[model samples]
Target: ANHGLAGAEFLAGIPGTVGGALAMNAGCHGGETWGIVERVLMLDRNGALRERTAADFEIGYRHVGLRDAADECFAAAWFRLPAGETAASRRRIRDLLEKRIASQPLQWPNAGSVFRNPPDDHAARLIEAAGLKGLQIGGAHVSEKHANFIVNPERRATAADIEALIERVQTRVREAFGIELVREVRIVGDKA
Candidate 1:
């Protein structure tokens, strides 16, 4: 069972499926889905099945790399957890969820924060200081509340528009602060 404990309760709010969660190592707040993983059940293309330990894979912040098995796919996972106070865990989850609702643009169709924070400094602070908050390119605009987030105000923005805006923000931030902002959101498909 997928335990949505602590700050991981945000996983329940995410619209993606379990398969996507596995593929992306999806997490939120301070909780990572893979942190509690003990073992994973996988199936090969030829229908062969196997069980592998979490230690058998390379686990990172938002990525998991399997060893020499690109053709295999995760079928399920065994997660180990310590017995804890249910009330406390539920309270913590509630608090984290409240914090996320208050801070993030949950009402919008955003793919979440556009860039990851670099080192000790925050990407939002950098973007805001660079005067990028509330900046807009077509229907895509940098969120005024959180500079690191780009929101779709009109919901009709093309990929090119978002790409251009992201590039502009990166360029401006780099030119002003000499910090290169790396994108967190994966951009796919051809540019229009």
Candidate 2:
């Protein structure tokens, strides 16, 4: 891992930028991004960069500070990770990648996990148990391989398709298990 960061290895195979990851507190395999962060560099609308430490900003699961409506954007991050053996680090990275492939729907165009794990239970388990696997709305389908993933098979699924499927899944899970599914995939923009 760069800068001898212990947790950076856990992010192997994750497709996204550091800014996005930091904003979401992105993690997998029990390693969160903020856990290794020492300092953050933010840019404002005027292109001025400001340095802020971890304590200067609020940190939580998939949350970051707003700087009180300052409209700052993440520019860079400095990680504070400990050194470790090179070979062991590489192996651990490979292992985590394998784990991700086996459990995630990586073959399709999808935006990672659609819902967060609720408490002591996994969202996939809940969805699969509800008999929602292989369900599709338009071209977007809940992955037969992993219920938590909504895949755009054939790359023909529109935003509406994905959004509709997400809503359906949420409704069904709520009705069946009495648990409201909170979306983890951030949605932006309006229907064109």
Candidate 3:
């Protein structure tokens, strides 16, 4: 049953490197990758290698805290799980996939969720209430189907386009509802 089960079924759909998964604790639905992590192997800048237990790092929802040591990289991870019915787990995974495809704006090149759910509140509802759905900035637009997502409808959007749209949405939501929406997507690189 252990081999037949689909406990890590969500891992099959995520598009990220194993190192990214370990660093970000990437997950879908309610299953986090870190929940099953048993141990990690890391390499330092000087090429020194070490093994650390899961308890060695601070694991949080969708995030992992690394030590202050510079030039460290994740080498690999070990996972643990119990057995389950293979067919049933596969069916559950399929159902989840179907639901996501139907409800999310996956047809466009938008980063998944723009903002994390605030304490006891959903980001989508707040954005919708601010009248931001379908709002546009350059080639990027807020997905009408899902307010929390910003899609590049024109396919010509730069990172600046997306960043501006996100900030506009955040500002509007804050102004209208008095609640600050915290972004889920990590914005990197210099400003354009």
RMSD per model, one decimal: 3.3, 1.8, 2.4
Model 2 per-residue lDDT at 32: 86
Assess candidate 2 and give its lDDT. 0.85
Question: Could you tell me every candidate's TM-score relative to the true structure?
Answer: 0.79, 0.92, 0.86
Per-residue lDDT tens digits of candidate 1, residues 1-192? 135343345464654556556665777766677876678898889999998887767776656778665678889887767766667777766777777778877777687778867888989999999999988888888988778889897798778889999999999999999999988676867765
For candidate 3, lDDT tens digit of each residue in 1-192? 237755677765565578888887778787888888888899988889988876777777666776544467799888886778878787887887788888888888887788878889989999998999999988999999899889987799888888999999999999998999887777767876
Candidate 2 Cα errors over 4 Å, as ranges = 2-5, 67-69
By descending TM-score, how would the candidates be arranged?
A: 2, 3, 1
lDDT of 3: 0.82
Best candidate, TM-score: 2
Better of 2 and 3 by TM-score: 2
Residue 87, candidate 3: alpha-carbon lDDT: 80
Local distance difference test values of all predictions, in order: 0.77, 0.85, 0.82
Q: Write the per-residue lDDT of candidate 2 for residues 36-81, one digit (tens) a residue.
A: 8888999989999999887766777667776466788899999887
Task: For candidate 2, report its TM-score.
Answer: 0.92
**For model 1, what is the C-alpha lDDT against the true structure?**
0.77
